[model samples]
Target: MKLIDHTPQSLADYTTAQVANLVPDGRHQALREAIGRHQDEALARTIACIDKVAAWRPGEFNYLHSSQYCQYLYYLANTIWVREKDAASATRLFLLNKALNGIDLFYEIAMPAHFFIGHSVGIVLAKATYGDYLVLYQNSTVGRHIDKIPTVGEGVIIYPNSAVIGASVVGDGCVVSQGARIVDRQVPPRSMAFTAPGGELALRPAPEDLLREYFRL
Candidate 1:
């Protein structure tokens, strides 16, 4: 079924009906409940983020209706709602993500606005902080070590089956290669971190120079 056929020019052009149709059929009520939890400012921010993502991917109409990105939108909205002290709504969205995406993401985790979850399944983000435009793939883990946690920067992409743990700092525009393990280290901006044969991480310039052209840097 076609959920969203046209892209709105702005958030003001988006109607509740359109949003309702975009969400999964059985999840409409939950989406409404979660949106209802947002106050004026948080609601505005959430709407803006939705609009921004839609505008960012204008050609991909399915992106709006995809369960993966939809769950991300809900999580982003819940983060704003929780910051505004709307605990009930936050908890509901968190549970909804777990139920729909099958991932464990705590509501207290700091997921900033404009962050992107490429694929939601098997992803864990228990980091200290996440910057804007972050992209997380499936089967990736961003955990912590003891009391210290990883701090990710803007436009960072963590590929599938990769893990970034411990007091690590990932700079802006850094790409963690698939299956790489980064712990207790720092990655420079616009660099790529990949695992060597001996399981040691090697840092080099990002393979694709056009990454900034595709992602927000």
Candidate 2:
């Protein structure tokens, strides 16, 4: 007997109105307000971000999966607008993110665009500065240790059940391996942090050698 695949078509085939329907009702009002506040060109840029995320999959698309990217888009836009002191619009998106994404990400957290939150459940991001293209998986944390917060660089991948805590600086092209813990240490760029023989943390140079398959290069 042959099995059949029942996956939905790619979201790239849908219209803007159809894509917008995937967002929750509560978020729609806030999204419209946020888009309205921006100029026409800026609005187009924001839509482009949404489209980019929507078209990520190679073939079939699922609304349940793609909707998370929409949540990320709102959260990123909210962070940018909040930095410009648009309190009302920012609050709306913040509330929407909390309600939809189930992540305890504060509005003060400086997460720029192109940051992906995979499995948003159990992920906590404090008031830390995040560079572009940061990918965070479930059960991973980025928070303060004492008075200092982490400064994460671009293209840093924090895998599941891992963390970068305190005033640590995670350099570009670094991968925090799953179940690894990095606290208050500067991880050099293009390196990998993993568990040593005695369960201690060790950094391996040139993570791309081992971790290239896990992240987008």
Please report the candidate that would top TM-score against the real structure.
1
On the 0 to 100 scale, the lDDT of residue 199 in model 2 is: 96
Candidate 1 deviant stretches above 4 angstroms? 1-34, 37-64, 67-84, 208-210, 213-217
lDDT of all predictions, in order shown? 0.65, 0.62
lDDT of 2 by residue, 1-217 (tens): 1101321122222312332555444444544544444423333434333434423442222345534444443544555475466665455545555556666776566566556666777788888888876777888899897898898888788889998899899998888899999899999998889989899999887545433343333
TM per candidate comes to 0.71, 0.68
Best by lDDT: 1
Deviation (Å) of 103 in candidate 1: 2.6
In model 1, which residue pairs have backbone atoms overlapping below 3 Å? none
lDDT of 1 by residue, 1-217 (tens): 1125543323213323344444445544554544544433444444444444533543233435444345444554555555666554455556656666767677777676765566778888794788887777789999999998999998788899998899999998899999999898999998999998887899889866435544444
lDDT of 2 at 198: 98
Off by over 4 Å in 2: 1-35, 39-80, 209-217
- State each model's C-alpha RMSD to the native: 6.1, 7.4
